[model samples]
Target chain A: MRSKVWVGMVLLMVALLMISGCAKKAVRTDGDVSQAGQDAAALEAEKARRAAEIEAARLAAERDAKRLAEEARLREARNQFMNEHIYFEFDSAALTPTAVSVLKEKGAWLDKERAVNVLIEGHCDERGTNEYNLALGERRAQSAKAFLVDMGISPSRLSTVSYGEERPLDPGQNEAAWAKNRRAQFVVE
Target chain B: MNFSDNFLGGRVRRWRRGFLVLGSLLALAVAVCPSASAADYGYIDLTNPYLRKIPLAIPDFKSVSGDPATVELAREGARLASQTLDFTGYFSIINPGAFLVDPKTMGVTETDVDFKAWTGIGSELLITGLASLSGGVVDLELRLFDTVKQERLLGKRYTARQADLPRLIRRFCSEVLMLLTGNPGPFESQIVFVSGGNGQKEIYTCDFDGGNPQAFTRHGNISLAPSWSTDGLWISYTSYQRGRPDLYIRHRLENRGAVVAEKGINLNGQWVPGRFELAATLSFSGDEEIYLLSGGGKIIKRLTQQPDIDVSPTFSPDGGRMAFVSKRSGSPQIYVMDMGSGHTERLTFEGPYNTQPSWSPKGGRIAYTAMEKNRIDIRMIEIETRRIVQLTQGSGDNESPSWSPDGSLIAFSSTREGPSRIYVMTSFGTDQRRLLSLPGAQSQPDWSPNGIQ
Candidate 1:
């Protein structure tokens, strides 16, 4: 802190000397003028070096912030892939038009991010028996996978599982909840 | 609550706290009118199923050595025997308050029970138990006496450790049921089921009548569809422990097992009766198809060729035929395929959705779940006659019908009281009662024959 203050003071003093030298050229001695000129040159070099260092630190900080933001954005993208589900009708695994659109987006995302692998989980409403629901859930998951493969995602990168009615997205025993529970969910592996 | 405590017509006074505690289990104490054939002592009419529950009397058990510990055992033994017998949906227990004589003055033998005292109280049969404890071992003798004829129908003696009293009593109950029903009842059996919800499900097993329920798998992940091997040694189930559905065949007692973690879903692993192999739904072939897998989970052969979903394979008692659910005909229906010829035929035509076919051990009927007006119920289809009998009705969906080892009872799961729980009823759907209550819902019950080693 003291050195920076000293440097500022020196620069101010040199500026005053130059201003005075310009105004009173006849009163200044030759040796005094030469010393001031030498000091000015060295001060110019120090100022340039400090400006360069400040610019480098600013660029470095900006790059680091950009990298962190990109990482967070990728994490959010993965989360969106896991949460967007393809829903089905009662006791049926046939994909709806809305479900197909959602799978289309999923396929595009998977295609853009080639390094991703996912496990598609098939689920069911609490209406059917667990054994049948398990099989139905698997069928639903396979339905989603088939559509994604049709949209150009590698079948190898996509796996499937069936939670049956074991894990319900909504525990409510109503129509709305049952509709929500009968879905195909994605889990990034 | 003393005289008419049991709808079966008999109850003992002060059998202990456990009696009153378990006495509430008289939920199944059905009002079977007294049988008219009480004169035919030692004879059971198999043709007349669901006959009146035999009016029975069980006196307080006595200790031979008069040891305090043995006396406690005797009391518990009597209560347990009576409770187990009551669970058979037989023996309307007669009240001991109406007994003409005290049990302490009589020996636990056919000759000691006074015929006039019991016959006068409407007791058709009676059970007398005696216990003796020595060096941490208990000697128990239980006898079933025909009070009408004043003759003993069955008698057995067993010596076991203190903790094994339930097993000993079950052995005696099996004897009693053997003599009465021809086939021993489910007293010697156990039920494996799925319990727990809210994103976690695990496998559980309990003795018949819902005693000693404990978690069979600690996977802490979603485990569904537990199938007990007919040999009573292995339990096959599907667990999500490895993050994907895999079929796990684990020994009931040992610490070793095999897993089929094939590429896609490995749904339900059902063991072939009396064989070292199992059938499971594997999707590695790009579609859900049933395949025969070795007991160690090695794929032996693909059993089904279909573009539609075909899963849940159940073999007949003789392994000559396999029954399963398929969507080959545009809707979910059950189909049976002869194992020898691989010829498949649709066994159900009444459904837009019919699945979960459980082949009865008796080999003539296959019990399955059917949907009627959006409500699920258990229905049995006789193979030869194509007679479908609706076994469950008017309760919150009752599905997953598993036949007891004797085929006289069907154990299933229902949501009649809200959360799904295990329940049992006669094959005729009479005397419906909750089997057990656990934290979280229970489903997918599979009964094993002779739960004891």
Candidate 2:
């Protein structure tokens, strides 16, 4: 009887040990799968972060390029306006046809911009009396102002003044200087 | 008590005392005198060529009404004339009470009046007048007599409102000066000067008396040396508007202008007569030289042979001769040249520097700036005799003397006020006054032609 009882106890102990070993293997497998799932989630999150960073950089570059292009266009327009001068005829307060054309083009540009206030400066050649020349200069400025107003620019936006014989475009006493002096200059304020 | 006898007795006593005092003083001074028989005439020796004053007598004009108000008006007119002449620094008006003749007794038509009376009173010139209120206006008849010459020099009738008596008196006095000195008066001329407003020197026009000034050039550019055209229609000036010194002409009536010349320094331009020629200083030849240009901006001839500085040319009334300042003689001096022959003659001596020669309209003399003995002054040179009469003295750099149309006075620029201001004085260097009291520095005063009515 005692021998049979010992055999039963040993068999029970062996069965219980095998069952605990299987449970341990199942728990180890569950931990490894959970850790692998966490690693995969971290990798996918890193990929999404990198994609978002690239997209932000690309948008910033596009915005910078757009701003530079706009600035370039503005610079070109300003340069064109700055380089053009209004010329006049000899001893004439009246504007020449070419001066009228240039003024028209400038007026169109100003129309597009609408916020620009210009100063019309009347100049004269160094050949007349100072008092009389001043009066002539005022007429030249008025001539330019009249044209600008006719082209739809508001009269208040234009200011006319005579430099008289004070300001000359050329310092020579030759025809070249008189030609340069007979002009109305447009300046952006 | 007899009041008249008592007053007479008192006056006799005072006179006796005054005579005793005067006698003793005279005796004491005569003991030390260089001559024992020196007369007691109150006269000052004018040994210096630059005399402080030439004694003159301008008495109250005899009024017809003899009313106190009329008398006062006549006295005021005479006083105005005296002040005007005195301001010219050439005349020292003697008081009538200091002499024997009463100013009330003198008349403008009394040509037989004793010049000995004025000479006895040590007056070199005697001016007398009569004023009458007729037709609701003041009619004044003035007479100027050279007591030394013993002849009447000026006689004129002027009619003006009673209120304008002061100005009329000044104008009449200036005319008298022209008759005596042979130069035009600057009283009625105009000057164009530059003033700083809004950070730029703008051109402004004012009367030679510094009245009725108006701003003409408003462009914010540096204005310099605004010269008048002979016709008074245009002004040629150099402006920095184009970033270089360019020549420009401003027309009078149209308020329009044009560039006359360019590409170098074109400056100091004066219009030649008939609106056909312009004389200007051009630096196009790498240095400043006088160039003659057609009215339409074509170079006709070069006035100066050397590339030295030759500027500020003023033509005679007939345009036959031009007076210019040249630096060829190692210093700036006035030179007169025949416009047709180009024959140059030096007109100034006794000064290291002389510039800004202005030919008198009558062609008798040239007015210019002269530096003498470390002092800059205005001097007039007789064209034929080369006699230089210094018109100004002291430590002021009086420059740019412009002759009046009638050759009586000169309008000039001086830097006595820390900045340049225009001044008018007699050709004798008297009666200087500040004209055109505008803000900023005003200089380069050019008198206009006769704008008289």
What is the DockQ of the complex in model 1?
A: 0.43
Where in model 1 is the C-alpha error above 4 Å?
A: A1-80, B1-48, B65-68, B451-453
Docking class of 1: acceptable
TM-score of each: 0.80, 0.57
| Model 1, span B151-217: residue lDDT tens | 6666667778878887788777876776665557888889999999777889999987887898999
lDDT of each: 0.81, 0.67
Could you list the chain B TM-scores for each candidate? 0.87, 0.64
Give the interface RMSD of each candidate.
1.4, 13.1
Give the Å error, residue B159, model 2. 2.6
- Cα lDDT tens digits, model 1, A79-182, are 78888888999988999999988898888889999998988999999887776788889889999999999888998999888888878888888899999999
lDDT of 2 by residue, B27-63 (tens): 3332222122122111211222124466888878889
lDDT of 1: 0.81
User: Could you tell me the TM-score of chain B in model 1?
Assistant: 0.87
